[model samples]
Target: MTDVNSRPPSGTSMRPRNGAAKDAAPALQAVAEAERDRLIACAELLFFAYRDFTSDADKVLEQYGFGRAHHRVLHFVNRNPGLRVADLLHILQITKQSLARVLKQLIDEGFITQRSGREDRRQRLLFVTPKGTRLADKLASLQIRRIEHAIHAAGPGADDAAKRFLFAMIAPKDRDRVHALIRLPEALDTTEHLEQPQERT
Candidate 1:
């Protein structure tokens, strides 16, 4: 026979008794700290990796009296000819003043050209000149060799894993837009019908 007083109260929670909860607190905290440390290490590794990755191109850009901004402008304009000024601003996330300075330098140096949109005359389209294309290709080749070597060292599936990691690093709000941009067919292939070398108006 069960005595009603011996039973747990109807609303009482079945929980760790005696000092069990207190004993587990330290263990849980330790696990959280360890995970935080691991993430911090990964963040530091990214900083070091980016420094080395851009070093080679930085030297070449220095020779041309340019910098990372110039390299980025050249790269995107080369890849997506006819990219709009507003779109480039969004991609770079820089102030109009900053971009104006960079764009003026590239245009003056004969590396990049600007054109007006056929449909929207006010739209300023950007493209890399033949000189710009060569420079962009050269910079890309240096980075590609480094990436290829790293991927080979990382073994099979590294490329896919690396891409997934990079995509995940993008902001949650920007992920869908970035995914669309990367997945699009090469702009050159699709825009081949347009005259690529039109003089900037």
Candidate 2:
């Protein structure tokens, strides 16, 4: 006699209803975590690399009582003589007030000169003085040495790989503008100087 209320299950499966899905979830989670960790490590390396890369020029800038803003202003003007102030603002993507402060400092210190554009009198054109040129060259040489050393250590094709990586890092919308700027004749011509010492005047 079987008592329904006291009956015991002789054979019953204990597995979860969707055991396969449950197992796959943890595996997918592990892969996602690994990828996140790898990306974070790469980002940290960039931070460290930038710190050391700027360390050399930072010392020289400190001697002149100038900061990174001044260095950037000097570098661009030295590279692109007679650049428009508007164009510079676009390239830097900083507020006009900020640029004005740095520009005034450089101009007052005799490191930079400004003139009216021939075609547009209202347009301010910028250029670096000979003194500024020397400083810019010095800063560039410092960074260039570090870059060349890194490239050598990275082996063949490293330069191209680095350029591609950096280019891809830029925002998609701005990539075309950046590409055009670098492709300018002046910019392209200056590329040769990065590997050679600029003549002292």
Give the poorly placed runs of model 1, Cα more than 4 Å off.
1-18, 184-201
Q: Residue 140 in model 1: shift from native, Å?
A: 0.5
lDDT per residue as tens, model 2, 78-100:
98899999999988989999999
TM-score (C-alpha, index-matched) for candidate 1: 0.82
For model 2, the stretches where C-alpha displacement exceeds 4 angstroms are 1-17, 184-201
Clashing pairs in 1: none
Q: Write the per-residue lDDT of candidate 1 for residues 6-28, one digit (tens) a residue.
A: 86879886687759888999999
* Weakest lDDT window of 10 consecutive positions for candidate 1: 187-196
Give per-model TM-scores: 0.82, 0.82
